[model samples]
Target chain A: MDCLRCAYCNICPIYRIEGWESVSPRGKIQLLDKKLSNRLVKDFYKCTVCGLCEVVCQSKLELTRIWEENRAKLVKSKKYMPAHKKIADAVLLYGNPYAAEQEARVLLNSPSNVLYFAGCMANFKVKNIAECTVKVLKLLGLEFKVAGKSEVCCGSTMLRTGFIDVAEKLFLKNVKNWQKMNVEKIITSCPGCYRTIKSNYPKIAEKKKIDFNFEVVHITQFLERELKKLDLKLGTVTYHDPCHLGRHSKVYEEPRNILKKIGYKIIEMERNRDFSICCGAGGGLRAQFPEISEKITLERILEAESTGAETLVTSCPFCVYQFSKVSRLKVRDVVEEVYSSMREVELKI
Target chain B: MYEFPNVRVEVDPEVCKLYRFDLLKVPKPFSAFIRTPLAVFQPENVKDLLEILKFAKKRNLPLIPRGAATSAYGGVVPLKRSLIVDMNRMKNFEVENGKLIAESGAVWFEIERKINKKGYALRVYPTSALVSTVGGWIAQNGYGIGSLAYGSIAENVEWLEVVDFEGLKKVSGDELKFYVGAYGTTGIIVKACVKLRKNNPLGVEAFETSIDKAVEKIDNAYHAAYKNAEKKIFLLAREDGESNDLGLKAWKERFFPLTGYKSTFSNFSEVIVPIESVVDFLSEVEKISKHYQVNFARGEATILIILQSRNILKALKIIKIAEKYNGRPFGTGIFFKRKDKDFWDFKKKIDPKDLLNPKKLKGNLILNFAGLIAWIA
Candidate 1:
């Protein structure tokens, strides 16, 4: 939608990382131009969408957002990432964004009363996070029930994969399910689903008058609010700023403070906060460009390793899954970060 | 030399600051400033530069005195913030004394021709004599290709006329001579009175030997000449194909073989002839190259003959006698443009000041000048 071709090509991370002008945001703009002009685009998936370009942009342009927007337009015009499209289709059909259904769901008071939606990653690849989430939330003495096989996709994977129209359809389906289930509060371990439910549910509700609403909270925010009551004794933990939670939503301080009360040291990386390097998993680029994403992820791990913390912590399940794949680093979900230090996880409800 | 008519002008200090930062970001733009004003305010002859200055003042702009922007460090604005006054336009020049009075805009090529016309050859203006303006060259301490022998631009200039944000002042050889290489911090240089060495009919012309042998033999030769001069004698080594990134490796391979030959491009590298101490330094270069991996081959060079006709025969005889040293005539370099190959386009691409601004050699601008000088015994 916007042009990124300007002289600020100097110090561009894509160019800096790759050591060439052809891979930078401006270069992508040129590639996009060629693709649009019927000149044929080459290496269409070289970008990892690390958001480093967004950091250097004086214009504050979300270049990745532009790519995703362009991708949607491309898909409409039949230029699509087939693998990505299949994943998004899975999210559309199954209750999970992954190709197959996952059986794990956490205990909440009711699916509607206080639904704990463990998004695809935590539900499948990172099932331990879901178990820890159930244990921790129940320790607070909250009423809960398990919807192990009945949970639906939060439409986050579809949105990221440029299936917004499909995402909206799924969103409406979730609204109908939540209204029928009478969900008063929805808690999600995934920032993607947390944001998708929070930002999109209201729009879907307004149109459909689903009339089933209360609060949608990320697990970090839920733990932060009940932190004093729960008396978390975890000491001094180093927290990794998950890209979606920290940069996308600006939820940085709550998780840090929660980790502190849990008695853990919070050591930071050289690049943190808004400038935090991507963990190499976003923008559907992992499927489209794995090496590009892997290098950025490796760099982020190296940054964490430099901190010398025993436990590397984060709040998103996807970040949890990605970090778990990195060797020699003690990567744990923020829920695990909280539950580990607790003499117990309260799963009584 | 061409006469440029005067134009109405005024000076401004503010706009000069902006011009100096075009495509460059400097905390202090003043260091890039040169005090030699090429935009002249003759107030008499050519007043266009003066008018331009006036226009700058009216527009609330600073006046920047620029030479060729080739110094390693920033030079366009030597002062904190200043306007750029380019003096490349002034051309009419004359050489009177060993000192030559030249317009600030006139480059070394024109000055060289005027001096040679009078049967006097200047030992100054070496590499920069081609494209460097007298004022800019002085500011940069530019050395001709024979820097090891003649020193830099500062060693070549005798005096200057400089204008500043304060007022116009005359700096001469009689004044502070060290200021020649100050790179316009003294002020905007508007004119220069340079010193020229007389041409000795019996001086040596050309010679070539291994860089090591030439370094050893050149010192003895420099001392033997009555006129007493020394110059760098070297040749460029070139090979085909830049695709393999062989610019440096290929040149180095001409004499010394490097271990790794798999580099994609030739990495075009050059052999440097530093100062009068070349003889003492050749071995050091070889050792350092071995230590640090510098790609260069030691080779012979053609020295310019600067002696009389009678001695010219003797110089040629010595060159022939030195044939055992492995020496030969080096033809001119061949360069093909990457794009835009027009007759005049080639000339436009050359920096015309390459030797003076050695940095320009990699680019499209090189300036050349040559002429005849006659003397009666």
Candidate 2:
């Protein structure tokens, strides 16, 4: 391993706050070394696996993969962090991290070609993107069923943050639910939900006898396919690229094109696309380390401010919810584009 | 000299974009002090300084002098081959009858802002010209975007004043047409007087035309009107990229007359092309863009053109003709013009020292070494 002589972590915000190697890249690397070199069972599952170091590192090393590789090694050694184990167990028992899984369900009973998988965010936050997406679908004149809160956690949050056994159990449970619904395609807005259902499920389902023949789509890809009708209108706004939605999944332009069509003047922030700043609400920080997470959220807000934007818009409900926590600026999900048409306005000049 | 451990040293590690923050990279030893000599020597005033060059000569200690950290191309940094004598601390500015006098250390932003608020303009201005000290701009023969009309730094400068490392004195005026943008090849620019405009000229912009027609119209129209309305006009074309549909383009068109002006690039990306090959390159782009679905006047390829004259109508006519030639026009803008001053330093050769940044970009020479200075080994 190459040595970082600057040792930026000497003053790394997260490492300083936490005071642990597991939270720092250098420490994480050392832990990985011990787990790989020494035969001891390292508790590798506790990390939030946030890519903050990747954001700050001058060398631009991929630190998240370091977290994942160590997790895989811990799995081999049969070691786990308590918090992740509890989360994995909860997801296995209930279909989501939340206890209200069954009550969150609302099946798509209508004749629809598209299944709107609202994921955990909309299940709890509901109105942010859910209602707006349905309105947009109706405007496009395409048939879509609101899985209303009915869709089980695509089991994405469980798979990530290292709860492998529980994640595997969730994969088995959700596959049966998906099959029962005659699901052909699953479209979700959450990056965590999108990535988990799209990438992680296939890995776990490889040995299952469940012959689920369907495709998983993020709402962004789905929206790009239906942008002609989104002819929804808009004004000047900055789009926040969520970490899961951006650096993780590499989906950048679909939403910008959508905003453009709706007549909104898109004000691009300086750090955009792959280099997008994090909302600080992801990778378990929201629950495990609330203060640090909020700092990241504010940091993203500061980035939006640099653009002199009139509004902050994003595709994920998580971003919408996190952004709303700030009283300083205006924030919205793509759903607001739909909700606006229902209102009438007269400027008092 | 005390023996020391090995370490790479470079002067001017920070590349200035006129912004306060710096982009620094440690490189070979000489790069650091090649331009900013005062960084090492915390000496007293200039009373004792002329004695040093002679003293250094006896001991063979090479001397390097530099202006403010304002050279656009890293021109003001000291050479590692010698001792540095940074001249930023020297301040000498005089104002009279719309004319301003400056020492080597005087900066553009301070003077321009002061003159601008008072409704006046400088004699010469480069893009980075404002940030650079008077001595630095003159020595480098700097060029600004108003290049076509002003014809680079050499054309705008009116006079010069210099002091060689050996205390030699040289003075020139606009009548002689001395070296500018020459990067201090001459002596140190101690004090120089520059020409100034009676009116304040701050930068303002508006959209005009879209395509080659934009260029053609602006060029022809400006020339057509120049007889009666000769005014200095500054123009820059860009690649703003194709809007998704007619409405977006139409919106842009509504804002600026889209018929003559078009764009083919995104906002804020740079276009610094070789001059001799530009016209031919523009012509080829004009013909081939049709198949690529670039219907806008300024798609994929755009050019920057500056027109100068006192007549404003000359500029308007050029805009009209630019419209006829298929240009996606934005709008017109106003800028305060600063007349060029004689750069006494570019003419006098101190030395062309190699000051290299340690972290070089792709395909760059990391070691730009020179043989003048006795460095700490």
Candidate 3:
């Protein structure tokens, strides 16, 4: 709450587009400080929850958490956007925010020590990410279970949009399912899902007096270790850090390492790693404010294109989907890059 | 409520409240006097600014021109219930002919980054440059990070396009003194063209020395400032790899003065003392509070003293001590109005109606009594 009112509004993706202080991180904090929940609910939700403000913050305010907790408070006050309400409703109704049929879920029901949580986005929206991830895992000789139909939403969108109670329910369900399956480790391609299960789930579980033993990780973290760097040239490509993975989970170098190991010369966008520009698909922004989200996505896409890299590679499926929508440049998940590299080596043989 | 079809205007109580204050945290006891702005307006261009001025003239409402609101001088704080002209949306800049021509709301760091790509750098920028706006630095005290070598922003500025009640006109040379660091009382700075230098990589070094010796070491360096009250000099020069990790850390942290100390104190005051008097001035500051810092410039040291326990008395005592050393509080915004008579004359000439950022460059009852309160205490 000790916002110095420095107004570092330029760094914010939402504020950069909206050009309003009310939508900036500092302004939202001030609004919350003043207890203007009615105004805070609308303005705060405009954010993509990218921790750029935190990265540039002199105060080092944990601004993403502040936004989330404030959104939770606003939700308790029954003051939230209808879009956020729709997300809560969908998560409750379909066990996932996408409202996809249980039959459409690609469940690898085999018993294994590892569970590949494809998240809601990979399962429904971008199915190739999950399929490629499965192929990559199989190629690496790892026996893992994909929580397809049985998988509950990791409660990332729910937590971000301030449906913590609903998110907790889903989290508990998923944790219980993984525990029953004797899952020791969970890996996911979705940064949102990875961050939630790896970071938020344990915290929430502790608060609720529930315990689950599973090592959660993003696919990049898993692939960077398991997938050996083959002798192949994959050409130059730029990496876009998913906000949930880079700033939220601190999984920056793993993705870059994975890319470098796959034989692609990484031409970094000017804003890369912790300082990376968000892909504008996280924190329920793409689901709620598609136009602003797309504009932000376009900004990142422009930055990526400026690098002159042939492909825009990222680990998050949401980033892939969002960038694919507006970006003319090629977008691929890091797993897809690895899968392509593996296939290319096979073709060479 | 003020309105322009192209401009964004907000009268929401919550939004206005956010614009009501700046970096200055007026304690609860005295904060009641600071009024929430009637409205906040974001004008995107010069045309919108003129329209807002015309509307303000008609309404007889004073417009507080605000940049990043990084200054703690109450320059952007609306003393009387008035409209806030948020200048951030007008951010547009270009580097041409070895100068950066920028809208007043363009961030200093952003402009520096833009020019750095073109192998040009700002002559002087506030240490708060990361968040401070060009107009904010120009409007308030602009002697900061690079001022050790380049002097104040006044010396570096080529011209400023200002819009007062009269009309739009470019002011430079002696006229800039009336507007630059006048806290927007003279006129609203729409755009400015400032001098730039070659973007040379600066190396930093830490020196443990006396106050005067450290100030002496700052001669012709890119930047030299006291890292803390411990008299450790964090000096930046044109040389390569002349610093340790602490010096590099200090160099990196120049933009983050408000970081890591948000809860340390309730309020702070910026004071400027002659280079000769820094030793005495700092000694006096040490007597009162250990939470103070000094940034050395060409011939002066800008000192920031955290007021102990949010005590107005202690803050006033520090100001009185600074005056003894022939120093004055930085920026004449609602607090220190002793200097800058030319600003008063210019305000009378340009904004006789005082429609542009009123209640600054002058004091209210509470501020006027600060000295007396200090003396009595």
Candidate 4:
């Protein structure tokens, strides 16, 4: 991971908030190179792992990996923040960071080829995203099964918070669960889960030499093809690219494709697509540093507001959860907007 | 033991490590030269800066005034245990009286954007304008995108408000030269009143031409000379709606140099030569290094030689190569202190205690020895 210290500081989200070099990717890399102890581990965690730095990085360093790997080292050495430890513990104990019952998380059990992986965020925190995703799936006449009690966490949170070993355990368990259920494709509403399963799982499977064979797709990627043109003029709406769905997985256009098909005018924020600012919900920042997290969230919210759009549509549950907390504009998962638009067409029909 | 409650100071060793170096990686043997500061301070206002300055004076601590830490030279890197005044937090700027008045820490891109909105444009801004602060650029006295039309950053400045051990003082004309490229060895530049021009619709045009011919045609045009991998000099100049793809690309990518390389990182150094000698200089270096980028603006050409490794010694070889073609290093910052005797004298008079970025204006033997090796190599 050669980091060209170009100091493109404007692209960094956390650095923008704290105005501290320690929080920037370049600064963290420099510190990491120095091999400093746990005193700066918290500064490393301050990032949203948005991959914004990587986009403009002259060295093209996989900065998110560097941040995550450093965090994993910290956790391994028992030097990570207590909040991160709590989330890791909650995931290990309850299969969800929210500490909800696994049985209660099993929303539906009807066996089907496609699995709707309503991630922990959708299931516990922002339930409406899951509901909207399910509603849209049903409206599209897609046969999908809920993972039921077999669906453990997708391990996005764990992987991001430096508990990769724990995340790998969850990844293996989920692979086994999906294999037993005989699902051919996995659709998730959370970008975190989408990225974790679609990107991280394959790597882990190869490492473990497990026969993990399930096609993973975010809800927007899945719905983009199935949704029809509504042409209902849903007014001007801005799309927020969740760090996981957009930069991490390169799924920038699928959600935008769906939004356009739904007949909504998409006015872009000054920062969009690969350059989109983080919603400050990912990378465990929302859980660990709530105030700093909210400050970042507010900045994004203000950017969304500046678009003068009626609704702020995003593809990820975490983005919706964070944006909804502070945004004055209506924050919605792309699935919700699609569901509402489909429902309106159904009423007209 | 010392504290200024009014300012944000970090004595945490871990955090201090983050400020140990600037954009330059300072590879290996040279890396050992940069010491982590004892404490880092973020001064929000002049009063806070004064307090931090006073505290440093009392403790006999050297003050490292830094803005964005964008310099590749070890300008911001502490030579010993020092107090770093991170000027980034002091960013505050406004357009006033047909000129832009900005705090030293104000980023150039931010200033440019704000001024552009008010129908004014900066006369010159560094290629790292997006991240580099005004004070930082001014400290380097950089020449960039608009430098051809407006000259070096020093030429466009109205005045500068610099803070020293005593208090804040406004310096302009002859006094400004001491601070412009002094690398903060004299005092911390708190604010600057920069000359601005009316915002015009900027377009670009590129053509292959000799460096001398390009210089002949670049009258009052915002120009940049880029010699591609093919050894063709493409002079990209600001025009009106006549941009070919190459011209637009060169203009669009003015900030990013030699980034198209497939490598994870690039090691580069900037050297200035006579505009007429740019072609020969680049041709000479190209024979050896094989990888270089030319940014010809103002009356000089800045050749950025992208090296193969992180070694500063290797980068210094380009400087030695540059000297053969009558070239000099762009910014004197600790690395080329010998080139600017006037700045060294000013540093002593302004900061008599040598408490302001010491060991910076004074070049050391080890670095000079490295230069000797580079010259021999």
For candidate 3, list the clashing residue pairs, or say none: none
In the range A103-178, model 1's lDDT, one tens digit per residue, is: 5554344533777878778888888888888888777776655456667777776666667788778777677766
lDDT of 3 by residue, A1-349 (tens): 3665666544787887886677878777766645664555677789878888888775567888888897788788887778878878887888877777966777887867888888888888999998999998998989988776778788888788788999999988888888888889888889888888878988998999887678888888888888787857778999998989898888889988988887889998877887787788777787778899889888889988888999999988888988998888899999988998899888888
Alpha-carbon lDDT, every model: 0.51, 0.49, 0.80, 0.81
Fraction of true contacts retained by every candidate, in order, equals: 0.00, 0.00, 0.62, 0.62
Encode model 1's per-residue lDDT on B102-178: one tens digit a residue: 77766565566556657775555533243346776676554443333444556666667765333456766544343
Model 2 gets an lDDT of 0.49
TM-score of each predicted structure versus truth: 0.48, 0.46, 0.94, 0.93
Give the Cα error of residue B281 in candidate 3, in Å: 2.4
Better of 1 and 2 by lDDT: 1
Best by DockQ: 3
Per-residue lDDT over A83-161 for candidate 2, one digit per residue giving the tens place of the 0 to 100 score: 5566566665666666664675544566654677777777667555766666666666667676554456666555555
2 or 3, which is superior by lDDT? 3
Each candidate's root-mean-square deviation in Å?
A: 26.1, 15.9, 2.5, 2.8
Q: Interface RMSD (Å) of model 4?
A: 2.3
- Alpha-carbon error at A71 in model 4, in Å? 1.7
lDDT of 4 by residue, A196-246 (tens): 888888899899998878888878877888877788878999999888888
Model 4: per-residue Cα lDDT over B291-348, one tens digit each: 6667766667787777767677777888887788788887766776655567667666
Candidate ranking (DockQ, best to worst): 3, 4, 2, 1
